[model samples]
Target: MRYPSKSALLFIAAGALSTGASAHMGTDLHSHGSFMTGLLHPLGGLDHLLAMLAVGVWSAVSARRAGPALLWGPLAFANMLVLGALLGLRGMGGAVVEPMVAASVLALGLLVLTRQGMNAAASMVLVGGFAVFHGLAHGAELAATGDAVAPVAGMFVTTIALHLSGVALGWSLRAANVWATRATGAAVATSGLALLMQLA
Candidate 1:
């Protein structure tokens, strides 16, 4: 299994630093950078990051028209997440949301790594369904922060970029070797476990 090349790790590190810098400069959920913070919130956590990337990697492993669907799946998730936040904002639902999101991560990662011969369409439907949990989490956080549109927009774009980057890397690795893909799936599942632990 290829660990993230030093360069890739370094790149992620740099991106994290950039987000931290932006966040500290008043982009937290409370203030000026609320929107930006909302976008970065997903990447800011390990569970969400790995689960989202795993979605793409798992999608590519299946035998369908994987590329466009893989990209669209996460985007759809983010969109729905915003809608969920709106729901939360209106005081409709609360609690257990993050746990469900983490559970989706665990389930999807396990599916991608262990299940074989499942149809590609099935995988798409499964992952897309899980994405709603993720989207709601994003939306709920954004709604709570009450940041203006611009900051949230900034955060949204940055996060989508991270998801796409994960998808691209996952696809590239899958092209290189099947084991690499399996290894990624395992790592992603492990991350889901970690998220569950935190919640517990």
Candidate 2:
């Protein structure tokens, strides 16, 4: 696959730097604690959307170059997301969740930008680690309501669907233009950096 040109990289960096400050960290879904609320929560934040998509893209790209087993990265993310959410339900790890969620976006975007591949085990661990923070951020919001099963389940299903969609996109991009995938990664990475700045 071809690498992104220096100019392209510079442009992406400039755009990221120019992004307006905004935070979608503490979304309130407590008013209607239903499956739809949980399902839509991931779509509510740019950070969550990009990070989850990046995971799927990374998994697809990695599977093509590495092995089919690497496709399990998304599953690892889903499982860990639930686990982290459970912890969040108990009001644990509230302090650093949002920052970590932002950081996950940055890390996952870089992974896609480079199209890096690791062993399946290592890949799952990395993805799972990032997913925990995402789950924690959302789960913390629901702590007070104490009704987590339906919402968490909805979030879980939506996360998988998003990952699959990303996988399809990544696969198609890889087949048509490798550069497109790289550009997508660059944009995602830029968004991640912008989100981090918002947190900062």
Candidate 3:
């Protein structure tokens, strides 16, 4: 039996997803710190979404030979995000916080762009570090709330969804154009660079 083309599948996947988050730094979304906010957090921001997508896709691409990164990679990220939120709640993240956040996106995008074969364990560690900054961003926002349970729950759910979507995209793109995916990585990396420049 013949299967549908990979590009066609990707097109369908892309069209199925949408988000309404903004990318403006210093934007405070701590209106109530509800679960819905946390769940929608990652889904709202373009940069954060790109980073998560890159992580999932990169993990998938690298894991093709070994197995599937559909679980461990995101687990590492989710765990580290909890730790990062703790740091933010404790007021531990210093001035370098925002830069690190941008760096996380840039680094993840580069990973996807390179498509260098990395063991799943190593990839988890790298993406775990990136997840910390991402968590810090969210935690810093909810620092005043003092309750991470609902928000974290929301965030974890949204993040996992994004990761899954990325996994699908990576798998589909594999049968499509590797260069096109790489081009996506390049664009994401460039956005991170532009953000960093703005920060500086």
Give the top-scoring candidate (TM-score): 2
The residue-by-residue lDDT of candidate 3 on 1-200, one tens digit each, is: 33545643453243222122235333465567778878777765566777777777777665655364456887788788878876776777877877887777778768777876666688778889888988887777777776778888888888888887787776765666767667656666776766677678
Better of 1 and 3 by lDDT: 3
The residue pairs in collision within model 3 are 21-44, 39-154
Each model's Cα RMSD: 5.3, 4.5, 4.5
The order by descending TM-score is: 2, 3, 1
Span of 10 residues, lowest total lDDT, candidate 2: 14-23
Global lDDT scores for all candidate models: 0.57, 0.76, 0.70
Q: Lowest lDDT 10-mer window, candidate 3? A: 12-21
Question: 1 or 2: which has the higher TM-score?
Answer: 2
- Sort every candidate by lDDT, greatest first: 2, 3, 1
Write the number of the candidate with greater TM-score, choosing between 2 and 3.
Answer: 2
CA displacement after TM-score superposition, residue 193 of candidate 2 (Å): 0.8
The residue ranges of model 3 lying beyond 4 angstroms of the native Cα positions read 1-29
Q: How well does model 1 score by local distance difference test? A: 0.57
Shift of residue 70 alpha carbon in model 1, Å: 3.7
Clashes counted in candidate 3 amount to 2
